[model samples]
Target: MKKLKELFTQVKALNYTDGEDVSDLLWQLICYSPKMPVRLQSQQLLDEATSFTLEVDDSHFSHSVLKFNGFIWGNGKRKVLITHGWGSKAADFSDLITALRTIENLQIVAFDAPGNGSSEGELSNLLLFARATEVVIGTYGASDIMIGHSLGVMANIMAISETAIKPSLLINITPMVRLKENFTATMTFAEVPQAAQSKFFESFESLFKVPVSYFKLTDLYTEGAAVKHWLAYDPGDKVAPLEYLQEFLAMHPSVLSKEYAATGHERIIKDAGLINDIVELVKQGNKQGN
Candidate 1:
């Protein structure tokens, strides 16, 4: 983390002659993958011998296709797909996966999104993440539940709305409600020039092909989707604001939410009780669906 901070600090100190290039560079830095490796114990659960791949359509770079890497564990009747957040790989859900493995006849799968982990790409966007989730669900063909954290929740919601794979239950942890809000915060923290902020937004929109207005979490949930949602979050999260979740729940009364005191954005998954609760919810939803 210190190294990453230093790298960003150096980049921020650079004197760029071209403002457009600087904006592009900033966007690239945001999109660039900071690959997270799976721990030894977590790697043990993964069936590295058998792997899966998907082709991601990269529209920004001449519509090129990128490869996405993933692994599947267990061969149970019910399927649970785990999606990690920004700059996070599938194996980050090690603790959750360890708990879920005990559930009988439950198949668990996870993947590294394009430009993340071992995936083939240099840059990624929300669309690519959504498409990757969709592809995994489509291929698996029997996803009963989905567990997502932060940006993973955003991708899951987008994939659920856009694709045919609607799971029985969705467990969203520390979900990012608004991309524009996040971007604004990021710019403020990075100390990006006021003149460069607009350029960054414009460049981002052009590169990702999605307007900032369309990036809200509320916009991703479509009515009549046969999915019961559980939202778990901590108000103290530094990256994603808890007020966003509050605002979303206000508008969408059908969703259920739970709050933890100080789980923050990243460590919520580390809670064993929370993982067990998620498993229990999935079981209940599976029974209800059947």
Candidate 2:
């Protein structure tokens, strides 16, 4: 994978037309995929599972349907689906998967969204990820709880809003609030020129079939959700900083927001304490619902 910084250097040196070319290249590069060997921990979880594929609509591309990869663990009535973020595979949730298994009669499912891990395709976006998630939910019949990290949280939100799947419990860890804000921040960080940024938005809106302004974290909650919502973040997180959700959280007083001192973005997902807290919350909610 080419470094975004390196691409930024190249993008910075170009004229408008040339910069547009590089901008397109940079957009493709931003759609990250796994390159390293799957961790033994993640591999172990995969080994104990039955895998399946779901056909998803992809009208934007030539393919009639895309096969989304997913795994099922345990056979309990209680259903939980977990999703990982950009550049990460389902195996990144190995710790949480293992932790959740301890819950009696609990069925857990996790999948590699398109252009990610074992899933098909070379480039993917939020819309694709959400559609893939919607398919998994349909196959699972119903989800009692849904957990997501980083970009996965946004995908989950979009999936829930756009589909019939209404998980009873929603957990978002280090989620991005304003999609456009983050996109612009990323472009700025990459040193993408002003003209290139504008060109990229035009390209993005054309491809995604939704204006960037159409995406807002608040809209997910505003669309009417009776389900329990949990938002967690680490103050020190560099990736999806906690401050991003401040205004959104303020508007939605019902959301349960929690803070951790040193967990950061990546480690928080793998943190034993954090995972335990999440599982405990799920269990507690289960008891309350009963």
Candidate 3:
């Protein structure tokens, strides 16, 4: 890691001297996401799952054709789409998959984001994940139920807000608002060079052509999108503090939310009560015709 930081320093120097931008190197650093290892239990669940791979329509970018690796379970009336967050994969929802199976004739679809799980790609970002999500929703169904955690929540929001797809229910765990603070905090924790911070955003913006601020979940359009929204998270989550959703909750008074004690950031996705809350919400949504 120290060597990588040192290389970033050298790259920053070269970026300043020569006209060449460090966006490429900085791109690799920022988007270099590590994949989560599939647990034996998760693997056991996946063994029964029907896997799939769908190509994303990312022709507007120079990235090679990317595909999402996912699994489908059950063949019921309503469909559910599950997504995992940073460093986590679709199989992390093995418990939820089991719980959802109790529903008579329900379809559950989940996928790994590019560069995460079994999906192809060496690097990934919020946009890439969101685009992959759009492809999955396109192949599956537009009016399905969508569940996301952490960064996955932002990706789901981006996918729905930018497209005509209107999911019935949007379930979020550890929902966050802004990207600038989190991005800077991540760079700081990774010991990124102060000079290289701006360079990385330069690269990110250059590729997306839109500013990094566009990734903010709160700013994304949700009107006439998911008619029902529910959030389950711990207030003490440092990665996505309760305050992050304060503005959003206040703005959307009717948005349903429940706070947990100390499930940390990622562990809330596997919380039993959280899972029950999710299942219950879906049941209610079904009853009310969400």
Ten-residue region with minimum lDDT total, candidate 3: 9-18
Candidate 1, residues 1-290, lDDT tens digits: the string is: 35457657855776655643676557655666577676788787665425788887887743798999998878888888888898888777877887777777788889998888889887777778888998888788757888888889999888877776667787889898998888778766777777777777887678667777689988777654546878888889888887888888888888888888687688888877678888788767666753
Candidate rank order under TM-score: 1, 2, 3
Candidate 1 TM-score over all chains jointly:
0.91
* TM-score, prediction 2: 0.90
How well does candidate 2 score on lDDT at residue 263? 86
| Reference-based TM-score, model 3 | 0.88
- How does candidate 3 score on lDDT? 0.77
RMSD of 2: 2.3
How much is the lDDT of residue 87 in candidate 1?
86
Per-model CA lDDT versus the true structure:
0.78, 0.77, 0.77
* Top-scoring candidate (TM-score): 1
In terms of lDDT, the poorest run of 10 residues in model 1 is 16-25
Best by lDDT: 1
